[model samples]
Every structure is written in C-alpha cells, then in structure tokens.
Target: MFWVVAAASAVVLGVAATLAVVFWPKYPALAFQPLADPSRVAPAVPITSRFAAATVRGDRAYFASVSDDGTLGVVAADTGTGERLWGNPAAGDADDWQQLVALPDAVVAVSAEDDDRRRMVLLDPGSGKPLWDRVIGDDDTLLYAEDTVVLVDREEDRLLGLDVRGQGRVRWELKDPGSLSGSRTTTVLAATTPEDLAAPTSAKGAPFAEPLDDDRRIVQIGADRSARVIDARTGAVLVPPRQSVADPDDPVVAHDGTLVVAESDNARRIVAYDLAKLGEPRVLYTAPDDNTRFEHLTPCGTDRVCAVQTTSSDAKTAQVVAVDVAEGGRRWAWPLPDTNNLVPVGDSLLAAQNTTPAKVSLLGADGTVRWTRDGVAARLDGGNLLRFAKPLSTYTDDPSVAGEHLGDDAVELGPLSGVRPATCAWNTAVLACVADEDFVLRRFAG
Candidate 1:
C-alpha cells in the first residue's frame, strides 16, 4: 500500500508540473538569425588629449575637470550636429565634484569631499548654472528615467521619488526584509497567504522569506524554497513561485516586465517570468549540460541573450545565444572569442575583445560582422559612429557613407580632449561619475 501511494503521488506531482508549464506565459523556441558581412577601418580624424573618464548619452556630451589653476572646466558636444555646444570647466564648486547624470533638461552634479557631506546639484546644460540643490541624508540607489529620480533608502527601507529639479517626494516605504536567520524566516511579510509565497534558500540549508518589491509589487520566498510573486497594487497573488529542479541562483530583470531566475541543480536551465500575466514561468533556454556555465545574460531590446561557456579540454570560448521572451524560442547565436564585453547597440550586439592590444567587433543581429577596428575600444553611438578610445574613430554603419565619413573621420578629440557623452533630454539631463579628478554629464541639444 505504501509503494502504491508513493507512485500515485509522484504521478500527480508530474501532472501538476506539466500543467503549470502549459499555463505559464509562453515564448517561442530558439533559432539563429544570420548577420551581414563586416567592413574594417580606422579613424582619420586628428587626435587630441586623454580623459580621466567619459560616457555617451543620447546626442549631447559633457566633460568636467579641475584646471591647473584650481578651477573646474566643462566641455559639451552636440551629437546631432557634431558641434561643440558648451565647453566651460568653470562651473560648480572648484574644489571637489562628482556624480554626474545627463537628464532630459539639465545636468545633475553630486559633490562631497567626504561621504558625510553628500550634496546633489542640478545645472542648466546650456547656461551651466545651478537650478536646484539638495543634500540627501544618505548614499542611496538613484535611478534616473524621464522626469523622476528613484532613490531607494536601504537603511530605512524606503523609496523616494525626486524631481530632477531637486523637488523631493516620498513615493513609498516598507520594512526591511530582515536577516535570513531572523525569527520570520518562513513567515510571509506581505503576501496574500502562506501558499502564495515562495521560499528563499539559506546557507544553513534552511529556507527564509524575503520581502522584495515596491508599491506595485511584492515578492516572498517560503520555507520550502519556492519563490512567489504578489501584486501590491491590487493585493492579489499572481504567480505562485515553485521549487525548481535546480537551486535558486541569479535573478535578472529584463527590459520588458520579465524576471529571469535561473537554477543549476539538476541541469542548466533558466525560467523567465512574464509579469504582464500571472502564471508559471516559461523555460526560455537550457544549456547543453551541467558543465556549460553562464557568464552574463543581458537584455537586447525586447529580447535577451545569454553568454555561456561550453567547457572542454581545448581553448574554451563564449557564445551569445539569443532567447525570445514572449514567443518562447531561440533567435540566433554569435560565436565570440575573447569576448570581454557585450554592449547592446539598439537591436544588435557590440562585442568588445581585448586582445594583446584590444579591439572592437560590431556584429549584426544575423551574426554578420558589420565592422572591426584594431587597438581601439569602441561603443555604438546613434547608428553612426563607433566611439573608439584614444584618437576617437567615428565609423558609420552605412557602408557607402562609411568611407566618406572615415575620410572626414578624425577622433577630433584625444583622451583628455574631454568630450563626455550626454543624453539629450527636454528638461533635466544627468551626468554619471562625478569626482574631484573628472566630471561627466549629459546635455540636451535644444
């Protein structure tokens, strides 16, 4: 009777698992899309100075530095017209500066000689004048989107939304999820019911619960080690997290409302949760075997690509395999050797290979080599120039025009030429990485 009951339970669990997959948000299988042939070239523009730091936003650029005479200097570039909009380093406190974000309208500056003196400043991109300034009490996680900056206070466990113009507002707040070994280990902090929660794994082999979400969503892991999703907006349980055949591993957020969580227990498989709908997660892609480990999985437009290493005795290489989140399929694959970094350029992948001297390889969605340059670090800019380090080389995606542009192409600026890229915005712009050594900002063209 015991044996019969055990078999019956196993069969029932298998059926439930199959039903869960069928009811989950479905996506297409994986397939490879071909790429176009690549063109190789180097920049012809005159080289200039070296920069301590640099970044590219939408179409404008901002660079800041302390001059020899103890003054700050800033340089701005118009990405659309390729003109220098503003080039003045004499803005802000000349002594110390840091944390620049290119907003839609203005550039924000964070200044502090020490951690206790943290201050944020908003500056006009065109005029280089301060708009608003505020002293955030703590060093919080700041997210800049359109007009709002999302600041998360980990210590207080609160969320604050501030206007780019220095208007601070409290969006929401929640208690800390608590330590894994706390008394509320299996207790649900903000779920609909006990069954609606999923358990998170602990190093002690005991599962704990973590309260993770904002005002719109709440997630909890249960004692059984299941992950569950809850809708904070409606206070309803949507996706009931399940224990994977694999253990809980890395969880990544996709461009769309998808949560990609992976486990490598029994095998190498990843489950992608489409938050748009409440159901089981679809198995997006699986590795060849347990030995194939994941390096990085990043969003490429609406879809995503996972870089995996197939282990062998010979020289191990990295392959970027694209996965469809909505349709549930594989799109294409790009084989990369020395794939140091993969920067997304719109719908394609920009693979950076650091050889003996380092080089940039631009690959199309179809796996074709669009362009290659030697001894330069390159990044895609607005479908036009591949911003290379050193004497900046601006390569055109248009093959016919590429030659013409290359002729006119001189990295007009050098390393210190100070052409920090800016994101063109309407009202507030942000510059990242502000420090006493260098300041970077994004400027709006208009």
Candidate 2:
C-alpha cells in the first residue's frame, strides 16, 4: 500500500509541473513588467462633449472636441508630462473642423461648409495659429504627402498638387478623374487624354520598362486595367498606358524605389517594378499552389517585403512570407494557424490567432518566432511597439485597459489605469490614446 501511494504522488507532481510550464506565461504580471508606476499615472483630460478624432506627433498629442454650445476646439498636450500645450476654441466652428491631419510643423484641418464649398486650413503645430486657408470645391478629395498636398476634384475631373509648406502654391494640376493612387508621400495620377479617351487602346502594348526618375513619377492604374507612370512634378505621361495582368492588391514602395505590387497573374504572385528603370516586371514569388492567395504586403525592413498569404477557402491555413525586394526571392515563411489578424510591428510580424485563450505570436523578418503570449488583444502601433489590451472587469463601469511596449522578452509599459476603447496612431512611435472613460489622453512609453 505504501509503494502504490508513492507512485501516485509522483504522477500528480509531474502533471503540475507540466501545467505550470504551459500556462504560467499567461499571467500579466509574469509575462510583462510594468515600465510606468501605476500610482504615477497622469491626470485625466476633460472632454465632456463629442470627440471626433485625435493625432499624436513628436512630443505632442492633438485632439478635436465639440462642446454643448456647438463650438469646436482643437487641443494640444505634451505626451510625456501630460501638460496642455495650446487650445483653440475659435480656430474653426463645429461645421468647419471635420478632418485633421498632422504635419511636421503644422496641422491641416478640413471643413465642409456645404455641398459646394470646402475649406483647408493649415495651422502652426505649436501655436494653433492659422498659417493659410484655401477654399476648394465640394467635389474635391484632399490627399497628403509629406511635402505636398493634392486635391482630386471628381466632378471637375481635375488633379491639383500643392506644396504643403508653401502658401498653398500649385505644384501641378492635371485633368484625370479615376486614375489617382499612391502613398501619402508620393502621388500618381493617370487618365487618357480626350483623344486617347475616344480610343482607349491607342496607347496599348506599351512596354512596362522605361528609364524614368522615380522621384518624379507615381505609378497609377487605369480603369481599363492598364499601368501608367505619371510625372510627379510636370504632370507628363512618363510611361503611357501599358497592357498588364497586374492587379493592385497592396502596393508598397521598396527602399530602392521599386513599386512592389501583390498581384495575381496565372497564379497569385508578387511583382516588382523599378519606377526608375520601368523594365520587365520581376516576378518575386509565385504562390506554391492554386489554393493560396496573397492578401496583403507590407515593407518588412529596408530591403524586404512581408506578405500574408491565405488559402482561398480556409482561414486556418495562413502563412507569412518574407521576400527580398532586391533579389525577388523568398527569405523565409512562417505558418500562422487560426490567425485572423496580421500587422507589421517594426521589422517583425504580429499574428493574432483566433483560438480560445487567444494567442499572439511575434515573428522576426527571418521567419523565426521571437515570442508568444496569451490572454490579450494586441495591435501594432504603426511602429516598433505592440499595444496590448485586457478587460479590466466584467462590470460596465470597469475600464478596458491597454499598454504599449517593444514586445521583447522583458518589456512592458502600461495597463494604464482608467482607459477604455483606446485608439493609437503610429508613424515612428505609437501616439498616446485618449481614454474613453475620462477622455484623458494617456501616453505610453518605455
């Protein structure tokens, strides 16, 4: 009887050890070490009325709030110390401050007064002083690049480019309606001329490769499924409409100025075109089987692109493929099972698996698993940091908390107090998010 009891005791101990090894990492305190003291959290900012949008740039956080009196105000606060930088109640009325875009030295706010009138106002980032204001037609769509802003007037079918820093000076304008597509830093506009419009195939069979300055051209796709490279400054048609089977899935500009498009030809493939060389499309990697389709492509680093390839009929069979942008070959591929969300964090990929006890995995650019954790909601803050969230309590009054960190082995920032439904904007850093409970914008940093 004594021998039998000893053997049973050993089995129970072994099971307990195994369970600890598997589940202990889920505890927030063990997986993450708090970077900021919970007791030292910043005071909440009062936003009693309607909150439209917010942006964080550099060291300041800017947000727009509407009061009970129907007046609109833009407020700026320091992210680190939570100090108010400036607040402009009369900058624009509630009807006038509909959209806000943050620039390096200024903030551009858009207002639609009526169906026929729209206003674009550029204000000093530090002082909220009006730098310049321009009234555009209601049919126009405003787009921004780092140094330039563009207005696409769909009704007038005109494309206007203006210098963001200058006094709203026109850089270039073209008459094209549906052929404008590019990143925020670059603009590509395309359309057939009146003569070419009558015979849209006039410029067909054009070669895809031509030597042109990438800095001066934006590659656009036409309604007829043709590719055209347009001059960025002079509005010249650098590469006229060319016949191609490429469909823009997710186009990204590589470090060397090559426009990489995740497209489908005979099979889903990644194609790279040097806007400078405009040569033959370099086939990067073709999907291994007909079942796989490339869904998204983002820059992994300076010289590689990361693509999420999913099976057509199964959500569980998804994988990430990292390809060398210069060599047009695969560097590594990692399988992500039951993953419903994928985003790029720094040079890595964050995959959120849709399983019970929810798991998150971080993958390096070389397809190695850096770390995996469970029991949190996460998203990339448009930078190198991972923002995590967990429900504070089951009661309605209990806030849903969030924090941001580098996602390394031993880094954690928040589980910031009194924050719920937080939204973050990312450039080189994750901007602070305004807490829905108190409307206080909290910044998380390591």
Candidate 3:
C-alpha cells in the first residue's frame, strides 16, 4: 500500500512538470495586467478646440492657431504625455494673418494688412516668443520655402528673396521675374518674361517653374516646355533643349532627375522629360478610355506617379493609376467611387467628397487599398478646405468663424489656399484642417 501510494505521488508530480514545461512563458513573459473590468479599457482622447495647425518637429508636435479674433497661439507637446499635451503658451490678437510655416530652427508667422504692409514674424518653438518681424514683399506675392521667403513686386516684375532669420542680407533679386512656387526644401523661381506686364495673367502663361536647386543653381522651365538648368551662382544655362511635357499644368520632378508631366491634353498618357537626355519624351498610360480627363498627379517617392483620372459622365467615380515615370509604363489601375477630389496624404491617396469633406485610403504601388478613414476631411497642408466651421463672410476677410457655420461661435482660422504639398515628414501620418472649434494638437493611430 505504501509503494502504490508513493508511485501515484510520483506520477502526479511528473504530469505537473510536463504541463509547466509546455506552458512556460519565454524571456519576455506575459506581464500584461488586466483592467478591473473587461469593459474598463482606456478611452480614446479626441482633439478639442483652441489649437490651430499641428506640425511635426523632430519627435514632438508643434501646433499653432488663431484665437476668437485673429490672435496667435502656439503649443508644443509630446506623445509620452498620455493622450494629450500641455496647453498653449503664446496668445495674442492680430489684425490679419497669412500662414504658419515650419523652419529648420524656428516657425514663421506671417501677418499683413496688405502686401505693402506685410510682416514676417519668427518664433522659437520652445518659447513661442517673437524673434524678429520684418516687412517682406507686398501681400500680392509672398512665397515661402523651408528657410527662405520670396517677395515679388507685382507691378515691377522683380523678385526679392529673404532669409527669415533677419541676420543676413536679402539674396539677389530677379530683375525680370516670372512665375514662382515653394517646395518643401527649395524655392522655384522662373523668369517667364523680361518685360513687365500691364495686367496680371494666369501663372500658366508665365515661363518654366524652375527648381531652385540649393543656392548654387536655378533650374528653369523654358518657353518651349524645356528645362533650362542654370548655374545659380553664375547665371549660366546648362541644358537648353525643351522637353516634351505631356501636361504642363501638372508637372512633378522626380529624384532621379526625371520630369513627369500630366498629359492633360490626352487623359490617357503621361509624358516624361529626362533632364539627362533632353528633347526626348517618354509616354506613360493612364486609362483604357481616351476621353477620360486626368486631374491630380501625386508622385510616388522618386519614380512613379499617382494618377487621378476623372470621367465626365460619372462625377462620383475616379480611376486611379500608377505610372512608372522612367520606364513610361502603367504600373496598375483601380476604380474608386464617390470621390469628389483626390489629394496625397502621406504615402497614400485622400478622397475629398463634396458632401462630406475628405478622408484617406492607403493605396499600394500594386493598386491595393490597404486602410481607409471614412467621412473625415482636412488635409490642410494642401491648402484646401479651411478649418473654420463657418464659411468666411467674404474671401477677402482677415479671420474666419469657428463652429459658426457648423453651429458654434468660435474664432475664425483661415482663408486657407486650396493647395497641398506632394510630400510631408515621415512622422506625420495624416494631417487635417479641422474647424477651429474642434482644434487640439494630438496624435491618432494611422
């Protein structure tokens, strides 16, 4: 009886050992602690009022916005601070304001009553204190690059480039300035006509949109739709041949020195101009149908172009295609429904609906829909759709009404231009222009 009892005890011990060995946790054990109740998960904190524009700076977020009456407010916060950051630090009323641009060392707040009375105010992100304020060009033509700002004299047809720091002299002004726009890292200033215009014409009538490559050379888009690569310091034209641009209205320069232009003339083709081999055109496909009209073309990294094709018969449906600019071939194509407008959001595409603002959907290079956000619009960086809830009293108004149109009375925030950038910082997954009443600087999962 004693041996049987001992043998049974040993059998039980062996079974227990086997169970423990099979179910043992690894080096990183299951250290998770359950909440008091199964339903007691942490609640999501949604963004709220008083924050303006939220831009990424290094690892933290820097947000800026206007108050009830055009006052400037700036705040900085980190994701480590639970779901939200500390409140804003800078707040004050201004008569009129332009846009907030992020610089390498500081943020620039441009305000003006008019172009002749424009002010470029620099602020330190840490303190939101005013570094310096200077009068730039007249209000009619104020353009911003990363660190540089260009002021154009509309009446005189001249260009003045200023370093926002106020410590350096203004760079050389183009005597016969044409059309210009600012990129994320560089400035594009093209001299279209040497002679001054009696009346302002559309920017398309102006000459090339040159990529101001650093401070060394100013790349030109020539009269024949060619790229005139010029030495920035010496003013010598490098390549003089005109490129066969498909869509002059929508042109993008790739990293490999290839120029991709939308074939607006032919909605089915994208014409590529190689800077290395000028005068040659590479053709890319858009859709099977020829009558389809192509609108927006966002670049995919340094090579491919994201094409948004529109059909006049079906206003709601859009055909999106990916084109390899170098090889001049179609990568893939897919049809998306209920899209009013198309914009680039991070690495994916955003669909702006006329009835319901805008939302994002991640589109892969192989034409796959990865993720999507439904019924939310505010890709504010492209400058479309003002964050203000109420429509502006007029397009020329200084400040906007927040929650006014959507049923609240808060300060107005923008007369925001309807332009979006091709690329944004890596940390920024989605950017939205929300009504100022619903303003806060916070992070959300992509």
Candidate 4:
C-alpha cells in the first residue's frame, strides 16, 4: 500500500507540472504597453490653425506654425516638460510652407514653394536657431537614414553624403555618374571614422519604422543605368549584391539590414542578401516555370518578408508566403487573391484587400490574422492602429478605437473614449495632436 500511494502521488505531480508548462501564456518581443486615460495637456506652441507639418524626434516636437497675422514659422516644444523649447515664425519661407524635420542634432526646414527652386534650411535643435540655408532644384532631394543625410545634388552633378551628427560636414562626395546608384555600408574611401555603432538604428520622425537597420547606403540609378550600391559613410563602392545586373528602373529594397530583390527584369528567382553577409545571397523562392510570377514583396511582421506569388494567369492561384530573414527560409503560406498591401507596424502587420471600402486585417508574426474588420478606415500611427468610426479626414472629428495592438489584445486605453487623434504625431511614449485648433500633448506611457 505504501508503494502504491507513493507512485500515485508522483504521477499526479508530473501531470500537474506538464499542464502548467503547456497552459502558460506566450508573449512576443517588445510587447505593447497600455496607454493611460486621456487628459487635456498644453501644447508647446499656440495653435491658431492646423499645422502644415509636424514631426517628433528624440525629445522635441517640431511643428509648422500659422498665426492670425499670416506669419509662418517653425515651433519646437519639449514633450516631457510641456514647455516651449523655442519658436521661429520668420524663418524659411515666409509666405509659403515650411516642412519641418527635427533630427537629433539639427532641425530641418524645407520650403514647399510653388516653383522649382526649393529652399533647404537647417536649424539648431535646441535653440531653434537658423544654422544655414541652401537652394536646390526641385528634382534634388535630401535623404537621411540612420543619422546620415545624402544630398543628391543633380545640379552639382554629385552625390554628397553629410553627417547629421555634425555641422553637415561632407564625409564623401562622388561626382562620377556611374557610382551614383545603388546602396552601401561604411568604409575608408569616404575617409570616415570607423563606423559608429552607437548611432540610432532607425530614422526618428516617421512612425513607419525603417526595419531598425544600419544599411547606411543610398540606392541610386547611375548614368549607365546600372545599380551601384555606394557606401554612404565612406566614398567606396561596395560589392554588388548580385552578380547579375538589377533593373535600373526597379528599386532596391532594404529590410532589417537585408536587401531583397529579383534580378533586373522578367526574373523568376527571388534573392535576399544579409548586408553583413554580402558575399552570400540566399535564394528564398524559385518558380518552376513561366506560369508562376511574383506579384509583390512586402515587409511582414518583425523579421519576416512576405512574398505574394501567382502560379498562373488565374487570379485564384495567387498566394502569400512568409520568409524568415535571419534564417533565410520559407515559414508560412496562405492563399489570398486580393492581396492589396501589407505594412508592418511594430510587431504586427496592417493589411488591406482590394474592395470598395478596403477590408482591413491585422496579421500576427506567423502570418495569422489576429483580427479583421470591414467598412472601417484604419490609420497606422506610432506602434498602434487608430480605428476611426469612419475613414479619417484631414482633421479627425470623431472618437477612435485607439491603443497598441498586442497580438490578440489591445492597450486597454479606456479614457480615450472621446478623443480625436487623427491629426497627431505619436512615438510610443507620447502623442502631440491638434485639438479644437489648439495644440495638446498626451502621454501614452507612465
């Protein structure tokens, strides 16, 4: 009897331990945190009308100001203290629009003029003081990724890479038209210091995260119409991602420090190259015959790339397949004939299908549809999805279904019951919005 009782107790204990381990809840990386109740907070600048542009970087909020007197300028406010850091109502274009981008080191003001002469101005991030100004043709653009700005000077016929951490110093400038295309990493040719690993991995302003990558390179089309990936930090030409020439018209895409592309034109194989392991490009997918084709490629979830393929001319043959980035292997696949678009937000993906009022589906990391809704307009801001009762307009006037999307759960923000966040800038921790023609700031986290 003693042996029988002892064996029974051991069996019961083992079953209990196995049950506990099996039923435990699973959570993902960078899990969503709940937002506090909404409260009326003061904005950094006086709001007389809608702001032309608004951006948040690091700790400061920058907005284009419009006064009753028709004066136009840029305003900077501290998101933490709710105090006005600085304001300049007479800088850049006085009568036109000023596009503001608050970089960690400097604030940029772009003149959205009505003509081809576009003006670019840099300002001190803290003091809101003007640093320098330049005029470039409308075709020229200033592109910054990972704290480095590339000035594609068409008029000067050169590609100049400037460090955003310093006084816009030129780290490398290549006047050769052939080396002007493709994207690259850091090197010594540009004579830049050993790569700074401490640089913030993503561009600050737009909440559409850029895959948190250090692919500090520019994708340019050269005079020979060939793709050449140039090291934006050093003026050196890095190895071409593929031996076969990529189509000049087709753009090269970078996701999570990996480059994904199909060869130039009418290619069947889809290849992905890890930037660090440039010598080896992984073949993710290969079509068996000409009937199969790549419909599109989209960044999915946190570390997967979704490739939509069609096996035949029949629309029913289309399907969505997920590819694991680091592992370089196919993970999941499901048929979806009307795959309109898929954009990754935080760890989830916001998907839209082709319809009159596009159907919205929130996909999980493993390509599962966490939630789906119809006839509703969804806005992807910060790490949350702002669900409006109706499609959002220029300025929202309705209460929204607001919170961070945590897989199958939400942020549980109850007090956002009567707030409109359509015209706001959010970056995980805080949100600054235009309310009642008044500027207000709201905190998302403790």
Total clashes in model 2, counting residue pairs 3 or more apart in sequence or in different chains = 4
- In the range 362-387, model 3's lDDT, one tens digit per residue, is 45546777545433323322111112
Question: Each model's number of backbone clashes?
Answer: 64, 4, 20, 7
TM for every model, in the order presented, reads 0.55, 0.67, 0.55, 0.71
lDDT of 2 by residue, 1-446 (tens): 99899999999999999998998542122123343332122222334434445665656667665554545566677766667777776455535446666766567777755667877778788887777778877656664444666676555555677776677788887765234542222224322111111110100111111122224445655434556666655556676666562543334443346667777655567888766556788888887777777755656655677867788837678777888878878999888877655555446666667777667777876788887766443432323344444422222232233343444343455455543333333222223444443235443443
How would you encode candidate 4's per-residue C-alpha lDDT over 228-336 as one tens digit per residue?
A: 5667767576645334434544434565566666543455666776554455567776666767666556555555667666676455666677777666667877776
Which of candidates 1 and 4 reaches a greater lDDT?
4
lDDT of 1 at 348: 53
How many backbone collisions does model 3 have? 20
RMSD (Cα, Å) for all candidates, in order, is 17.6, 15.0, 14.4, 8.0
Each prediction's Cα lDDT score?
Answer: 0.44, 0.55, 0.44, 0.55
TM-score of 2: 0.67
Q: Highest TM-score among the candidates is held by which one?
A: 4
